[model samples]
Target chain A: MKSHVFRPLLVVIGLVVIVLIARFFYVPSDFGSHEKGYMYGWHRKGNEDEWKAFKVKYQFNNEYCKDCHSDKYETLARSPHAVINCENCHGPAMEHPSDPAKLKIDKSREQCLRCHYPLPYPTSGRANIRGVDPEKHNPGVECSMCHNPHKPNLRGMK
Target chain B: MITRRDLLKKFVKTATGVMIPLAAFEIIDPKKLFADKPFKTDEAKVRWVFLVDTYKCVGCGLCVKACKTENEIPYDANVTRTWVERYVVTKNGNIYADTPKGARDGFTTNRIDLGMGKKQDIKKEDIKKAFFVPKLCNQCDNPSCVQVCPVGATYQAPDGVVLVDRKWCIGCGYCIMACPYGVRFFHPKYHVAEKCNFCYHRINKGMKTACVGACPFGARMIGNIKDPGDPVTKILMTERVGVLKEEYGTKPQVYYIGLDKEVR
Candidate 1:
């Protein structure tokens, strides 16, 4: 009888319906909303673009700083520090680019010591950044004693 | 001797029973598993590349600290986005390696307190040659981490930087194990796989990576390799570069200059 075949088909259909309903709940509606060309073809669900919008809160580029401090920028270009960005030590200048007075120039000794502190590393290392032990090299004296911050090399400046 | 009306009624009942179950079972479609929504695809504008001059690295460890601070990573935690390794070969053909706190506080041969010290005291003069090699995620052309992530949470961005979606990550360590370089780790706080993203947050803003910016020596270099005007690109074109584990065929984007044969 046709009823005999229909009974088996009905059971199979019941199982399929349960699986389909489970999938609908398990799979998120927005699975691939943000990840268009990313790896694994999976969409990024995080605030991946937050850095793009964070520009309004911070700016670290040196080009805008060069606008107002062109003379210093010119000097830096001629010195060994040419490649270093101004914001490395001075912090982000997003506000300073607009209001020049907002720029915070850090003249602390810690700033200079960050790069110049002496560590007993291998002599063969080619940093070209001559390190000095703070207490032994120039005890109680400021780093600006013998070196110019803008042009550290006396021979190069001359 | 059955009536026509009775037979018709039985046929109708059987058909309804079959069709109702069929409709329910047909609801599961495999296409839905891979169905992707239309999103704005950002074109690959610049392919960023990072270069390390192994001969020039002084084991300063400033890059590690800078990365830690930039990424707001805790100093004491086992998680490190980047680190450096010092490879020392003794004259007697003994190999010694150590990276205390990932060399975040620099390295010194005088001290061997990282619990990696040898049983025999080897004098410094007995060492044949030693050098520091900085390590980070290679950002391979064919990264295995991307292939193993079950949820597709870790992926390479359009700019060619491998990144992790912390929000979507189910704390699965598959990507961590998939990386052959041992660069990936599970963040203790976020509970997700974390690796060097090349500081995409900074690079996207047209700024150098935290490690590159922190290096006092011009040992670490990064730039858009595609742009001819980029100085880093010029260096890459001129220098004879090598990648770690080339046999793996990962095709890592990070190139190294003066890489010694001993380094793995």
Candidate 2:
């Protein structure tokens, strides 16, 4: 082979070897194509653990609150509001009865009206919820002042 | 001492000797070649599906707020994991749609933006019909985001949920551009690609997604599509459900019971 051709060929081979060595050292051992086939895309298996470790802010189950506030839990469980989660109105219980001690409870008129405002949409299942026109029904007073959230039914109210 | 023809014949013979054994090894046990390195197996038996009953959504925006809080997304950030859009169609067939603050705040005004700094107050009598439709990441069966991700940072999990590895993402923004649904966004703080993962942390613990738990109206639900007895599966089988952008062929898993033609 000619010296010019041989020299360029050696340089190219050296470059290829360097890249291969770099890739071997740089890529994580756990990285690969996963799930069903290569169509799913490549990812590091260890990264899934990072996502799984994430702590959700909202506590879906009411059992956690039951440990601390059994009376309120019992009252809420039997009421019409049984389907509602405690955290839905109260802010996220990520750190409760300890760090912040108590979760912030929303008592604003807008909070009650979020579910109780009379919307004209008939097709929506929200029509089944007992709603009142906020303007007509004691405008300034909060709903909690006249009613109880734990026992939402008027008949159950003291 | 070797002539050109003899040299060529020797090369061919040596090549055939090498090729035959390699071909036989592939034919006999192809997996054995790659089996030396251990790979993670997806043993999950569940296939998750999301159901949205548009008829049941009153657009209170609790789901949006819940998603934001649960995911730690900034309330003031323009990006949202989920949002509700209000669509109002006039009697004359003109359509107007708007999402104010990603519907984090409930729809307060009756006015609709006509675009380019123009707003029109829609009267009750002039409107033919109006409805709210919630939008989120479809978590498609064949996600274009996964396909376009140069670093393979975005992928679909075993439960049919598409996820992004924030650490692995190079912030190329290719996946954001490839997504037809426009669900992907750059994280405000991290500057990497971000989107909804259906609250994977909660679901794996046998709890509902944050948005689903926040909905007081039973408008949003999640169930396993693989289980024959699952409510979502039954509804998908028996009901007239629709997905957004069927023409895109992404095979979106989010099913809507009352999907309207006006919805994009």
User: Candidate 2 falls in which docking quality class?
Assistant: acceptable
Question: How many residue pairs clash in all the candidates, one count each?
Answer: 4, 0
How would you encode candidate 2's per-residue C-alpha lDDT over B1-264 as one tens digit per residue? 999998997997687455443322323244653553224433557878899999888778889989999998888998899998878788788888988778786654456756678887876667787778988999888888898888878888777788899888999999999999998899998899999888888888888999999887788999888788988899999999999999999999999989899999
Query: What is candidate 1's TM-score for chain A?
Result: 0.58
What are the TM-scores, per candidate, against the unseen true structure? 0.68, 0.82
Candidate 2 interface RMSD, angstroms, 1 decimal: 6.2
Relative to the true structure, candidate 2 reaches a TM of 0.82
Best DockQ goes to which candidate? Answer: 2
- lDDT by residue (tens digit), candidate 2, A1-158: 55897989978965765565566567677776666345564678777778888887888678989998999999999988887789878889867866568778878777777667754444455556677877788889878887899998887665
**Candidate 2, pairs of clashing residues:** none
